[model samples]
Target: MLSLKKIAIPMLTLLLVVSAIGLTNAAPSTQAIETLNIGFMQAPSSTGDFGVRLAIDQINREGGIVGPDGALYRLQVVYPNRPPFAPDGVPDAVTSLVAQKAIAIIGPVDNRLAFPNLEVLAQAEVPVLTLATTDALTELDPSDNIMRIRAADRFYNEGLATVLIDERAITSFALIQTDVDSTEALLGFEGILVNRSLTPTVKIQEIDNSNLQADAERILQGAPAAVVMWGPPEDAETLLLRLRENGFTGLFVYRDAQEAVRSGAIPISLARGMMGATSWSYTTPTELGRAFLVDYVTSFNSIPTGVEAAAYDAVWILRRQIEQTGGDITKLREGLLQTPTIYAVQGRLEPSTYGGGDFSRAVTVYTMGDLGGPQLVARFANNVRLGDDDLVATDVRVVGLAGTLTYTPSPSPTPTLTPIPSATPSEVTLTVPQESVNLRAGPGTEYEIVGQLQLGDTATVIGSNADFTWLVINHEGQTVWVAADIVDVFDPGNLLSQLPIVQPGTNNPGIEPGQLSEGIDLTIEGVVLSPPQISPGQPFTVQVTVRNLGVNAAGSFSVSAILQPGNLTITAGSTGLGAGQSAIVTLNGTVDGTGSYTSSITVDATNAVLESNENNNVFPLTYVSDRPILSRIDFVQIPVGTAFDFAGGTADMIWTGTQIEGQNNARFGIVYAGAFEAVDYNAIDPSVVINFILPGSNIGTGSLIGFITAEGRRGVMRVDSLVGTALTVSYRVYSN
Candidate 1:
C-alpha cells in the first residue's frame, strides 16, 4: 500500500501552487488550467517512481505544458492501488489510468509484468514508456504505443559477446539461461556467436537455482573458454558461486553481474574480474548523463540506476513531445515518429528500424574492479537492423584503461579416446519404451508439460531427482524432465550414480530437505489449507509445519499468516523447539475478498528467533474462494484470424501463460461454444462439459459459453456485444 504522506505531499504542494497562481492573477485570463495525469506502474517508493515524481514536480513548477488552445496543464502522477506484479494488477492499473485520462504511462519495469500486459496498455491508445529491456517486447507490442526508453537486451548480449569473442578471443563458449526472461538473451547471444562463425560448446536453458550444481558441472564438462549467463541476480550469484567452488577457472560473464554485486547477492571478492553489460552506467561519459546523475543524487540522496535514468528521460521526453504537440493525445505518437532524434540522459534517442518505439541503442560493457565497483571496459551502439536477420553489431569500441586487460586461458589436459576399465561413463542416455512420455517442467506430475517424447525417442540425461524417479533430459534442445519409470536407461556402463541430483524450480539454497543445518535454521516444510476453496468471509485454518533443521535449539518464535488485499492477520506462537524438532502451527483467519488471496506465512514474524538463512522464512500460499472470480473484457476488437487466450486475461493474440497452446489450453477459436442467454455464474459447475470445437460464424451478442482452462478450471463467458469481427465478453472463472 502507498503511504498517504508520499502521495498527498506532492498533491498538496500542487494545490498550494495553483491557489497562489489564482490569487496573483487579479485580471480575467483566456487560459484555463487543466490537469495532465501521468500513470506510473511501479510502487511510490521505487526508483522509477521517484524519478517520475521529480520530473512531475519540476514540470509543475515550470507552469506545466501549454496547449495550443491556450490552457496550462499541470502534471499529476497516478499509481494503481495494487502492486504491479500481482495477478491482474497491470491491467487493473491500466484501467485506472485510462479512467483518469492519463496522456502517458511510465513503467512496470519488470519484464514479467510488462510483457503480458502489452495489449492492455496498447488498448489504452496512449504512449507507454517502458523501462523493461526485453527485446521481445518490441515484437510483442500490438500497437505502436509501447515506447522502450532503454536499449533492448540484444544490445547487452551483443556487447558482452564482443568482449568475450573479440577481446578475450574465446571461441568455445557456454550459454546459460537461468530463468524464463533469459531465453531471449541466451538466443540473442547464441545468434551473435553463430553469425561470427562460432558455435556454443554448451547451451543450458531454463536452469533453476535448485539445479545450479548440476548445470555448473555440465558447463565444466564442456570446458568452454568462457561462460555467458543471463537470469535473475540471485540465481546468477548462486550459479557463479557453485561454478567457482567446483574449481571452474574459465572466464565468467553475466549481463546482470553488476546488479548481483549491488544487491549483495554476489560478494565483490567473487565478482572480481567478472564481466557484464548494461544499457546505461553511472560512469557515463555523456555531459547530459553526468548532469542527470548529479541532480538525481542531490535530490534523492542516492545514485540513480538505469531504471531511474530511463524514467527521468521518459518523463522529459513526454513533456517535450506534449509541449510540441500542444497537449494533443492523439498526435503524441506521430510527433514521436516524425522527430528524427532527441538527445536525453540515455544518449541519442533515435527511432529503431527494428521497432517504431525502440529509441536508444546504447550498451556498455564493464568489469568488476578490485575495489568492489564496476570499471567501464567498452561501449557499443548496436545497429543490427531487424527483419534482415543481421546479428552483427555496429559502432563497437573499447573504453577506458581497463579495456587493455588481456585474458590468459586456463591450461587443460588433452582428451583421450581410450575408456578406463573401472571409470564411469561421462554421459548417460534414455529412451522411451512403450508409449509417449510427457516431458515436464519439473520433477513431478504437478509440473506443467513442456513437451513429449514418443516411443523409441532418445535423449541425453543431464540430471535426476534424489531417488532417480524423474530424469532431466535435453528434449529438442529444451531441458525437460521425464519419469524414469517410463524411460529405459541406455547406460550399459552403470553410471547412474554420476548424474547430479537436481530439484528443478525449487529455491531452497545451502540447505537440502531433511538435512540439518549447523546453526539455528527455521524453515516451513509445508502448508495445508483446511478448506482450500471457500466462500468469501468464510473462516479457514492454515496449518504450517515449522521445522528447526539447525543443530542448535531455537527459543520462543512466532508464526503468522497475513492475507493480502484484506490484510487479515492470524498468528500462533511456540515456546521453544529443540534441534531437529518439528511443530505444526495453525492459524485461523477469514478473508473478505471474493477473488484469490495470497497468504504469506512467516516463521518468525517479529525476528525473535535468529536463523541461519532468513530467505526461507517467508512462504506464499495462494487460496481462492469457491465463488467464481469475475473479469470483464469490454469492447475488444480483434481480427477474425487471431485468437484470444483467456488465461492470459487479455485480448492479445499471444499466449503469455504456461498453458501449451492448442493442447489442454484452447484459445477462443478452439473453445467457443454455441450461443446461449442469461449466463448464471454460480450455476456453472466445475465439471460441466463444454463442446471444444470451432464456433459457427453466426455466434455473436448474447452468446453464453462455457470453457475449461489448461489447468482444468472451468469458466463461463457471456458475450455482451459484437460488431463485425470485434467482440466484447465477460467471464467468471471458478476456483476449483
Candidate 2:
C-alpha cells in the first residue's frame, strides 16, 4: 500500500473556475499522485551512490513513472541515519527503511553486512538489490526478494580461470587467499582448476595471519608462472608490493586490484599490467556500456567504478520492474522474476529462478593499462562454464566512446646481459633463420632487391640504417641491407653500437666513404660500487667500465665519479681503448653522512674525448647509505587489533608497526605527532622520547603518529581515515 496526494495546482485551478462561475460552494476536482519510496542503504561517499543518484535524477527528469492505479508516480530515494559500517548499521538501516514504507532497497554491498541481516530484510517483505557476490546470499534469502546486481563469486572465478588458463595458456599458477571473506571465492577459483584435472603449483591460505615476507619467499621458491590473489583491497596491495619487492616478476592476477588501484592503496605504476575480473569495466565492449561510460563521466566529472556501474544498473532494473508492475509491491517481485533479459551497462542480466535473482553471469577479465585504467582482455557471458576441451575464448578489442584502447601485454622480465671481455672486438653477425630473406639495395622495401640470402645463411653486420630497423650486412663481401625482424642479430659485446649509421638512398646502396670515418665514441659501459649499500662516512671504490664504441681508438681520457649531496668527485685516468674495447677505471669517494645520494659516473667528464655520441658518456647511479630508505604506503586499511609491518610492508598479527590496541605493553602503540607533512623523517630526533599509547579519539583522520618498530626503526604514519573497526593510514618507514 502506498500513500496518494492530491495535485495542488489542479485543485487550485478548479477552485478559481468554480468561483468565476458563481459556484463557490461546489467541490473542486483533483488528481491523485502516488509516491514510490526506494531506500538507498550505503555511505554517501560510496561510488555506488553515483549510479543510483544518476538513475533517479534521469527517471524524475523524464516525467516519472505511471502507476497501475492510473496515477503518475515519482521516485524518492530515502537514506538511513547510519552508514553500513556503523555499529548495528545493517539491521538499523533495514528497520528504518521498512518503517519508512520503502517498497524496495538498494545495497549494504558488503557480504558481511548483507548476510547477517538477511532475516531482517526478508521479514520486512521488501525487494532488495544487493551488490554482494557471495553465493550464500541466495541460500539465505529463500524468499527471492534479494537480487544480486553483480555476478556471483563462482561466475567471476570461472571467468578468471578461463581467461588465464585457456586464453593465456598459463600452466603454473599460485593461489593466495589473504582475507577470510574471500575463502569461498578462492575455493571457486581452485574448483575450476581441479575440475580441469589440475592443481595450483602453490596455495597460500590465511596469509594475513602468516608472515607475508616468508609467503613471498615461498611463492618465489615455487616459481609459478602467475599468481592469482584473492583478498580485500588492502591485503592484495600489501601482498602485491611484497611480491614485487621480492623480485617475483611473473604475472599477477588480483581480485581486488580495481578497488586497490582506485583507492590509491597502490599506485598505478605498481598496478600496471596486473590482471583482474570484474562484473563490469569502463572499457565494456557493448555500445550501451560505452554510452553509459561517456554519460557517467560527463555527469560526475570522473570515471565510474564497477560498483557504480552495477548500482546504476540496479536502479534501472528496479525501475523497469516498477513500470511493468505499476507500483504494486506484491506484483513487483513476480514482475522482476518474469522480466526478460536486460541489456544493461554491465552485460545481459537474467533473472534467476533458483533464489539468485538477477544473476547476470557476465564477467570481464581486464589487465590494467598504462594510463587509461583497466583494458579489456576477455569477456564471459551466458553462464559459459569453461571445460578443458570445450573452452570459449571471447577476447575483445574495446573501443571506447571517446577513443580506441590499445591493450598492451604485460611486460616480460628484463634479461640481464653480462659483457665478456674479449681480446679482439666481438663481431656482430646477422643470420636468416627461416626462409630466404631479400637483401634490399637500401634499408626499406622501397629500394630495389639487390640479392637474396638463403635460410641459415650468415652475414657480417657492418652498419645499419638510421632507425636500426634495417641492418646493412656484408653477404659474401656484397654490401646489402636486411630487415631487422627477419634476421637475428648477434652482438654479445654490443659491438653494433660501434657500427656506423649508414645513409640509404636509391642511387647509393653501399656505405659512403666519409660515413664510417667518425671519431671514437666513448661510453660508460657499467659502474660497480665496492659495496652495493654503504655505511655512513665509509670509503667506497667506484669501478667505471669505459668502452670505445666507435670506429677509431680513443686517446687518454679521465673517468670521474661525482657523488651528489656531498659534492665529492674522484677521477681516474684511462690509458686508452681500441674500437669495441673496454677498460675498467677505479675512482674512490666517501660520504660523510647517512642519506640517499646519486653517483654520476662520466667516462669523458672533461670533454677529453671527441666521441660520435656525447650523450652516452654519463651514467647515473643511485644508492642509499646507512639511512633508512623511506617506502611509502598510502590509504592501506587495517582492522582494529591488527599489526602492520612498515619495513616489510604487510599487515599481520605481529606487532611491528603501530596497532590500534596492541599488547606487549603497547610496544606498537603510536604517539600523536604533529601534522603529517610537518613530521620530517630525516629531522626526527632519535633522542626525543616518544610516549606510545593506544590510539584514542584524537587520533582520527589527518592526525600523524610516530612510532618505533620492534627492530628499533623509526616511522611516521598519517591516519588517512578511521571508519568503524577499520583504520586506514599512509606511512613512510626508514631503515635503521
Candidate 3:
C-alpha cells in the first residue's frame, strides 16, 4: 500500500495558543506532507516493478514533480500484490492500485492481464504503463489517460517480415495464424504494404488441425517462401518439429521473439540475428540502454529484458507526467498531447497515425540476441529491401544469419501416384443384323430401357435399349435401329470422368495473405482466441475483437470468408459456394494490432463472424488529408540544414479517411515528444493546443503533424524539429 498522508494544518489560533502554552515541541511539523500517491499495477510475482520503482524514485528523488523552487513532493510506492500475474489469475492488484489513490499506475507486464481491468482503469482515468506481451490490450483506445509505455506488437510482426526478406530469402509467403487473436491482427500487414503498392505473394488460412496429416497435405501442396507462425512457443515447437520431421525445411518464422528462443524453432545459431518488431527498442540509442542496464542490475539484482525495460519506461513516463502536470489530470492530458520525443531503453514513444491522440505509440524494430547483450536496431523504411541486407546484420550481430535459406528440397514432396485403371477397353461402333434392334439398359439384358436411346444420339449400345426388343428404322435421318438379338455392340466410354466437387459456400474477401503484392483493399480485424490444437478438445475459445470498419461485401454469395494459417495453419482462404448469401465461419488466427485490441468480432458476416452490434465495423486504417491539412515544402527531401516554412492551422485529420474503415491499411509513424510549450511551463490549460499537436503550418493533403495515433486512431508523426504523432490505419470502404 502507498503512504499518502494528508496533513491537516491546525487552526492558526490553536497553533498560537499551543505555542504560547509551550506545546510547540510536541507538534514538531511533518515533512513530505502533501504525499502524492502514484499507482503501480503489476503481476504479483513480476520483477518488472523493481526497475519501474527505481525509475519512479529516482525521478522523484531529483526534485519530485515540482519546479526548482516550487512545492516539492514525495511518492509512496504501493504494490497491489494480487495473484500470480506472470503465473495466472485475474490480477486483483489492479483493483488495489485504484483503491490507493494512485494518480498514474504502471506495470501489468503482460497484455492478457492488463486487458481485463481496462474498464476499471478507464473509469479512473489512470493510464497503463505496458510492461510485457503485445496482447492487444494496450491498443484498444478506451481513454486518453490509458497510455502504454511498452512498444507494441506491430514491430515484432514487421521485424518478422524483415527476417523473411533477408535471412529466409522469402519472396513469397503464406501466413498461417493460429486461434489466437494477438496474431490475427497481422492482416493489417498487407494494408501497410498496399498503401505503398507493395504486394506480398501469400495465402492466409484459418485451420482446424483435427488431422495434422490431412492439414499438412493441404498446406504442403502450395509451397511458400516461408511460413509466418503466431502461436504459443510450446505449440510452435510441436508444429515446427512435426513439420520439420515431416520434412518441411523451408524457413519457419516465429512471431514473438521469446517464442523462437524458447522453442528453438530456428537454428540456435541464427537465433540472435532474428528480426523482431516491438515498441521496446531493445538496442537503440545505446546510451539510455547502457545506463538502464546498470540501474536494472542494481535494483532487480538481475538483468532485464526488453519487455521488462518497457515496463520500467511506462512507470517513468507516468512519474514524469505527474510531475509535469502537478498531479492535475487536465495538465496530464495536455502534457501527454504536448509530450516530446521520449527515448527510454524501450523504443521512442511517438504519436500514432489515427486521429492525433495518445492512443497510438511508435513501434521500433529490434534484433534480439541474448539478455544483457548488445542488440541492434533496424532503421525505419517503407519496406525491407536488398540494400538493407547489411542493416540486418548490423543490428543484432550476436546471431549472425550468415546464409540464406532457399527452399529447394533435397527430396521435394513428389507424389508418384500412377493410377492406371485395372481395365482398358476399346472404343467401338455397332450395326444391327435385323432392320431394328432393341437397346437394353444393361449390357446383359437383365435391365430394362428406362428411356429410349436415339439413333445418332451416340448412346451406348448396351445390348440394345431393351433386351429382346425390336427397333423400327430410325427417322428419315437415314439411321436404322436393330433388333435386340440382331445388334452387335462392344465397349462404352468409362461411365464417370469428373472429379468430385467440394461444396461451394458464399464468398467473402477477408484479409488475403501473400507476399507484398499489389495492395488489394482488405477488411481485417484484431481478435484473441485459444491455441488451435491439431487434435480436438483443447478447451479453446476466442473472445474480444477490434476490427477495421466498413460496408460493401465484395465477393459472391455462398462463397466463404477464407482464413489461411501458415507454418501454424488455420483453414483455407478461398471458399466457392453459391453467390449472395451469408454463412458463419470461425477462423483461427492472431490479433496483434498496435495497442487497442478488445473482444469483439473483427468482421460481420453470416459465416465469417458476428461482431458486436455496438461496433460500426471500425477497421484499423488512418490517413492525413485536407486541402491544406498537410504542407508541401518548397523543395521535397531538402537537405537537413535547410530551413522550411510550414503554415499552421487546424486542418481535418481523418486518421482513416475512408467512409468504411480498415480497407486502407497503414503503418502509422510518429516522431513527437510529449511536450507543452509557448506559455510558462506551469500554465495548465486544456484549451491551449500543445506545440506537438500542431501539424506543419499548412501542409497539402498528404502530410500530417503530431497527433499520437494507434493502428486505429493514433501514433507518432514529426513536424520539423518539433516532433509530433500521427496514425496509419487500415480501413475498409464501400462504393463511394
Candidate 3 per-residue lDDT, tens place, 375-408, comes to 5455432233224342222221010010111111
Candidate 3 deviant stretches above 4 angstroms: 1-34, 60-69, 81-93, 114-118, 131-142, 155-169, 190-220, 246-249, 259-274, 281-285, 351-377, 381-736
Q: State TM-scores per candidate.
A: 0.50, 0.48, 0.42
Best lDDT among the predictions, by candidate number: 2
**Arrange candidates by lDDT, highest first: which order?**
2, 1, 3
Colliding pairs, model 1 = none
Q: Could you tell me the C-alpha RMSD of candidate 2 in Å?
A: 25.7
- In Å, residue 409's CA in model 1 sits off its true spot by 66
User: Could you give candidate 2's per-residue lDDT for residues 169-220 as a string of tens digits?
Assistant: 9888898887677788888888899988889989999836356667787889
Candidate 2 residue runs with Cα over 4 Å from true position: 1-30, 207-210, 352-355, 385-736
Q: lDDT per residue, candidate 1, 1-736, as tens digits?
A: 1111111122112111121232123212334345577888755555587678666655543335555444455566766544354325688777766666778888778687777777776666577888888776766765778888888887888877777777778899988987786777788888999899999888989745677778988999999888888877777788888888888898889877777788788899899988987777787666456555655665566667777778877787776566556567789877765544455666555663435678777777889888777888877665432321212212121000001111111112111111011121335667665458898756778766778888657677766777989887655534567888766665423335434454432333223346677788887755656444445667877666677878889999999977754777789998888886666677887766454445678899799887887877877776555453433322222213223444433222221121212234433332333432223333454444443443444245666656665566556666555544334455545455
- If candidate 1 were superposed on the true structure by all CA atoms, what would the RMSD be? 23.5
lDDT of each: 0.62, 0.62, 0.37
Worst 10 residues of 1 by lDDT: 397-406
